[model samples]
Target: MPSRVLAVYDGSGIDGDLYTRVNRWAQSAPHWLDELIKVWSAFGLGLFAVFMVLAWWRARGADSAVMARVLASPVVVVVAYGVNSVFKGAVEEIRPCAQIHGSVALETCPGTGDWSFPSNHSVIAFAAAASLWFVDRRLGWVAGLFAALMAASRVWVGVHYPHDVAAGALVGLLVAVVLTPLAGRCGPLVDRMRAGALRPLLGAGELPLVGHGHSAYRAQQY
Candidate 1:
């Protein structure tokens, strides 16, 4: 279980400036790049929650079966946050922001409490993308850019390690791959329940050939 935080705590630090080599290049970026990075990071990560809610709202339509499947994906995205919770607390990996270099202009997290393991930002961002990917590959491309921005911005912000973002991305993809079809499996039952196409939402969890591999939805149906 993710350790419950009674109050805010200071973030942890790296054992040493282990990535001094990489830092050299990271510091070379102009001020505009960093500012742009921060902005993109905000959009990439922050907007994911917004997207899911919007998608959920937009998902309501004539095909309830599709809606049920589509809705299931965001639910998995929500759940993946929980899954990250378990390992994130257990791992206790320090963030890069705590490292404190002269170039990286970041402050202590103003409100977002410190708990960086698998990048929840990356996970949700990608989850949002994967959900969209299930609906349309073109939009999925945009989602991919957004997810990548979230990961890169974390590094630029000096808050999360590259590996943290990588893990988050994988987790996000995993959530979609696992959840998409699981929602689909209920298609027959959903159709039966509504007696027809009730709402026209896409299948919620990742559909095979949509995001990541595996068909958890298919497995559950039988």
Candidate 2:
């Protein structure tokens, strides 16, 4: 049976040409480089997970506000993915590998009904990167670079058009920008958790001692 065409937008014009060019380049690239990109395109998201765990571990020693933002990174990625899914379903854009004739993908082409307007991998990666920005600037910069590479890899692997990854990156960034600040406001909740049985997860170090009675007051404030 033929796959249904439900796309409201088609990128088989300029985007298709660009994809073809990239695919040609990939075909001539070193075997090791292609293999590396294919592997990274598939599993690079795991690095973002590691980054998040590191951020969480480091935030444990920081104030509750910082910790709250770190904790919200995963949530931001989830929300961004959900939003990107809605776009994929609505746009219904077919994968470049399927839409472009005579195109060879480094990775296996996704099957029918798997709409591919905005790349999910791109969305998750950029969302994590943006969310991490609210937690730690240096770490966020590293994640941001990885996120860009991840987006490009999707196209290099011949699964997505340039526009798809670009739109996905935009969606992930917008969602994170809007949600991360609100997430940071959950500091009071983090404080409550620290006071309860979750202290081991939230607290990384002993509270600093202030002058006499002030130490207890400061501890309660955090």
Candidate 3:
């Protein structure tokens, strides 16, 4: 992944300099700023899950297409995270802070073997962002902005290099772009499951009406 990203950037001597500048900023930043970055990174890790569930909850019973995308959110997140983990395992690239000297990371370096080729936080964030976007453009844009912030926070905390987060974001976006359409393709399956035993659990109940024919319109549209 790093090699591919480097290729994409044509070895433009920027990755290293970017890392150095970001790390330097992290080192010299005010204490409160460091604390905020740390908090943001930690919050970023959980924020996607919150957004995904909220999206699913809000889409209950309206627009089958939207619900389908919402339902697919978990699958997108899991698959993207799994792919990121596989890359981490295969590459086993040491964390930037561990490799660079005089790197004052805001957060403690993870224990050895915590490979850092691509940023998991970025992967999950972008995956959720894409999923949310598929369901609703407005919400998707908001989530996408948050995803960008989360990616930056990973770099700000000195846990991920720019390339790492960039690759991760790309991986996540690709996964969503490829798989979100499954929501539309799997319309029959989602419809079948609507009245199944897990209906209550999945919140397969009627949602607040939108425009005319809300639920009826969704059924026919999807």
Q: Provide the overall lDDT of each model, using Cα atoms, as 2-decimal numbers.
A: 0.62, 0.89, 0.78
Extract clashing residue pairs from model 3: none
- Residue 211, candidate 1: how far off, in angstroms? 33
Question: Would you list the rank order by lDDT, best first?
Answer: 2, 3, 1
Candidate 3 lDDT over 109-178, as tens digits, reads 8766887768899999998899888887888898999999999999889887898899899999999988
For model 2, the superposed segments whose C-alpha errors exceed 4 Å read 1-9, 204-222
Better candidate number, 1 or 3, judged by TM-score: 3
**Model 2 CA lDDT for position 171:** 97
Against the true structure, what is every candidate's RMSD?
8.9, 4.5, 5.2
On a 0 to 100 scale, what is the lDDT of residue 215 in model 3? 46
Write the residue-wise lDDT of candidate 1 on 1-222 in tens digits: 455532223232332243343445557878787677767766656676666556556554324445555657668778777877776776655555544354243434422445666677888888778876664466567777878888766766666666778888888888887887677676666555444454233333322333345643432211
Lowest-scoring 10 consecutive residues by lDDT in candidate 1?
A: 7-16
Number of the top-ranking candidate, with TM-score as the measure = 2
- Best lDDT among the predictions, by candidate number: 2
Q: Model 2: how far is 19 from its true place, Å?
A: 0.8
TM-score (all chains, Cα) for each model = 0.66, 0.89, 0.81
